[model samples]
Target: MSTQAKRATIYFDPDIHKALKIKSLETSRSITDLVNQAVKEALSDDVEDILSFEERKNEPLISYDQMVKKLRKDGRI
Candidate 1:
C-alpha cells in the first residue's frame, strides 16, 4: 500500500456494494483495499497470459475445421 493514495468515484451494484460493506466489517479492511487487490490480481493474470502467448507465438496454427477432423480421426471427439 502507498502512503499517498488517489481518490476515485466508483459505482457498484447495490448487491455488490452491500457485499463489500459486509466483507469490510468482517475482515476489518476497507473496500478500497479489497478492490485494489482484486484489480492487481486480474492485471497479474493478464500479464501471465500475455507472456504465455508470446512463448507460443511461433507454434504451428490449427484451424477449427482441421482440429475437429483430427479429433474425429483420433476418436477423441
Candidate 2:
C-alpha cells in the first residue's frame, strides 16, 4: 500500500525552481519526492556518524603540544 503525500508550498528562487522542475521531469519524480528523499538520506547518514563517534569516544586523547612535537621530530610540521 502506497502512502498518500501531503501538499505544501515552498518558495524558491526562479532559477532554482526551474532547475528542480527540469530535473524532476527528467527523473520522472515530483519535486517533493526528490527533496524528501534527499533529506531522509542526509539524516540517515548523520545517524550513522553519531553512532560511529560514540563507539570511538573512549579510544584516546592526544594533546596539541604533543602532536606538534611529534610532527616536528618527524619533519612533517
Candidate 3:
C-alpha cells in the first residue's frame, strides 16, 4: 500500500462484492488493488474522451433541419 493513498468508503452490490472477493483470492491481490486499477482505467477512458472532444471542439455544427435536408438531397432519408 502506498503511504500517500487515501482511504474511501465504497459500497458494492452483494453479487459484485462476492465476485471481487473470489477474484482477490484467486489472483492473490487485494480488493483495493483491483478497485484502484478499475478506477484508473475508467478515468483514463474519460480523459481520452475529453481529449477527443477537445480535438473536435472547433468542428462544424449541423442543425437537425440541415441534416434532414442533406439526407433528402442524397436520397438517404
Candidate 4:
C-alpha cells in the first residue's frame, strides 16, 4: 500500500489467488511479503547446498553398494 512500492503482476489460478488473498488477510501481511519470504527461503537453501558442495569438493565419491561393501569388509557394519 506504499506509494513508493513497485507493481508487478503474476498469474495464478483463481482458487490459488483466493487462497493467497485469504492467507494474506489472515496473517495480516501482503501477498508480496509472503512470496518474497518463500522465495528467500528457497534461495537460501540453494546457497547452503552450494556452500556444502564446495566444502566437500575434495570428498571421495562412493556409490551406495560400494559403501555397504566397504563397511562390511571393515567389520564396521
**Candidate models: Cα lDDT each:** 0.96, 0.90, 0.97, 0.91
**Model 1, span 7-75: residue lDDT tens:** 899999999999999999999999999999899999999999999999999999999999999999999
Model 2: per-residue Cα lDDT over 1-77, one tens digit each: 16877778888899988999999999999888888888789999999999999999998888999899999999997
Per-model RMSD to reference: 1.1, 2.5, 1.7, 3.2
Top-scoring candidate (lDDT): 3
- Best-first order by TM-score: 1, 3, 4, 2
Number of the top TM-score candidate: 1
Stronger candidate by TM-score (1 vs 4): 1
| TM-score for each model | 0.91, 0.71, 0.84, 0.72
Q: Write the per-residue lDDT of candidate 4 for residues 1-77, one digit (tens) a residue.
A: 44576678899899988998999999999989888788779999999999999999999999999999999999999
Over the stretch 1-77, how does candidate 3's per-residue lDDT look in tens digits? 65799989999999999999999999999999999999999999999999999999999999999999999999997
TM-score computed on alpha carbons, candidate 4: 0.72
Clashes of 1: 0
lDDT of 3: 0.97
The weakest ten consecutive residues by lDDT in model 3 span 1-10
TM-score computed on alpha carbons, candidate 3? 0.84
The clash tally of candidate 3 reads: 0
lDDT of 2 at 16: 89
Model 1 regions lying over 4 Å from their true place:
none
Error of 4 at 21 (Å): 1.2
Candidate 1 C-alpha error for residue 56, in Å: 1.0
